[model samples]
Target: MKIKHLTRALILGALLSITGAMSSCEKQTQTQAQAQDGQYVKKGEGALSNVMLATIQSAAYTPTLPTKATIIESPSNVLSPRTENDNQNQINAAITNLSNSGGGTVLLGSGIFRIKSPIILKSNVRLKGGGQDVSIIKRDESWTNVEGRGMLESGGYIEDLTISDLSIDGNRPESYRMSNQFPLFGIEITIDNGGTTRNNRVYITNVKIVNTGMGCHIKHTNNVILKGNYIVGNGTLASSTHSLPTFFHNVYLRSIDKAWVYGTNYFKDSPGGNGLNITHLTNLTVEDNIMTGNNFRGIRLGGSSSIILVRGNTVSSNTDFGIGLAYDETGQPQNFSIIDNTVNNNDNNGIYIPNNTKNGEVQGNSLSGNSPLNIKKGTNLTNVSCQAN
Candidate 1:
């Protein structure tokens, strides 16, 4: 009778253990689903990167719109001397004519074109140049505000625009430093002041932008592509009364959607500058870029940004965290994937997720020689199997 009783107790204990284990696993799976929120629902293991890469490669290979028959121009071909007035007039003429004719390319030949005011881009007009080393757009010191916007501004509510293969020297020389109006960026794609939605379907590539308050600033834009550009903020040239490092970022994007920032290089000589500053964005992919030697973070997603993929980038040698996720009082960063990157040599954490930021994956990254990954807040955190080397 004693032996039979002992056997019954053992059987009951084993059954309970199995049931408990099953319950625990179910809870874990629920948590993962909640955290991921169906972002990677159809993505198989080890294939997420491949899928995203294919999308990028295809996009780069086959542009959705027609980009043939570039209209080429040059100082040598246009009126001679190609002073600030000459170059600006020629380029503007080409763009205006093309836009009026339903859009085309305006290619600039190898030369240094001094621009004293904004080069406005109209709908369906592309501005191409000789290689960055050969074609230069040097900002004239005498020039200040282009309708209170950037050196190269865009037409309001424009679409199918391309700016590629050039160098823009902001020339923020000591004489040109005005802290109040400091961010004299090389390119600024802005929505019309009173318009809610403008500036859509823009592409920028193979450009070298330097010595500016900000290299490139895009606001309220959609379907943007910034690829193979070298954006550097050499802060030594300008003196800001407000702060030591006058420059803010190499590239700044806000209220942008369906954008891909790939194969670009962003760096800064001084501290307190960001390689890329993103705010209130959606459906964005930032991959295969080099962001290093900046004052602040390499990449920052602030405000109410969602559906982001950051992968295969080398972000290092920064003063602050390598990759940072930020949120405002009413916003929470969500639906992000941080994978397969080599982020190292930063002064702060490799990846930072503060309170109010959740629903993300940090996996398959080689993060070393920096502050460890920090998950400051939020529950049901889905780390998704990271192997830190």
Candidate 2:
């Protein structure tokens, strides 16, 4: 009986020893993780406020403009779908007249309008549609010379313009299926500062853009807001024309500053191109966006961008990285913060920052299902803290 009791006590002692060892190991591991937190510096100091202030200072300030006055009605006297000639001239003429008379709304009532020529938007002009579902701006096949250019083009220091509640179909399947050489862009805003005008305060909202060579090309512009818009690159059409898919982008921006893009859906059917491609930007905020099913990175930042805050975004189901931060041809990205984002199911890393990147913070992100690595970093990556869930 004494032998049996001694053996039971020995077993209990061994179990206690094992438990104590596990507890000590756990405490040691936690201390190491806590110590690592102090290694990197946090970025995005006053980033949100700075972006907002810059937008307020530079934007066209059209809050007091009347909602329903001085209108240029569409079906545009001479340019309806049933008309024999394309309505490009009529549309431009109306826009020119409105701009000359200060500024007003060009109301697209209903139905699809075939635009054979580029619609150049002028200062303080608002191009509004009845609704996204009703008003369609389709590319005109009859205009062969203008095939690869943007259907609606803004340039020459244009400002105080708003494009809202419209659907632009690039007709990629019909246009590119037979010919891979066609250059198609949905909306392109180019800033030429040589003129006295500065392309500032451009507001785009509730716009549905699909099946284009690229969705919206915003280059060399400032104080731009792209909100509540649907920018899609349907893989079916892109795959139909094999070569074009390689160059497609849902929304591409270059040399833009004080831009706010939020509440937007970038729906890519296949791994075709990036959902948002930004380069050489400043004071940019991308929040509350849904980017999924993209072939490339969902959001890419490069070319020496600063004060960029990417927060509360769902970047998932992409064929490549969910968020890609790297160096461009000119320079490296800096002063960025990626926080509170849900990144998942990407083919590569959920968030990829090459060691060459500088001055960024990656914190409070819920990441999973990224193959190989959830967060892939490069050398010389500084001031960045990645707290994994």
Give each model's whole-structure lDDT.
Answer: 0.67, 0.68
Each prediction's TM-score against the native?
0.73, 0.75
What stretches of model 1 exceed 4 Å from their correct place?
1-81, 84-86, 144-148, 174-181, 193-195, 234-247, 267-271, 372-389
lDDT of 2 by residue, 88-125 (tens): 66677767877888777777768787777777877777
Choose the strongest candidate by lDDT. 2
Range of the 10 consecutive residues with the lowest summed lDDT in candidate 2: 53-62
What overall lDDT, based on C-alpha atoms, would model 1 receive against the true structure? 0.67
Candidate 2's displacement at residue 136, Å, is: 0.3
Residue pairs in candidate 1 whose N, alpha carbon or C atoms collide under 3 angstroms: 271-295, 272-295
Worst 10 residues of 1 by lDDT: 54-63
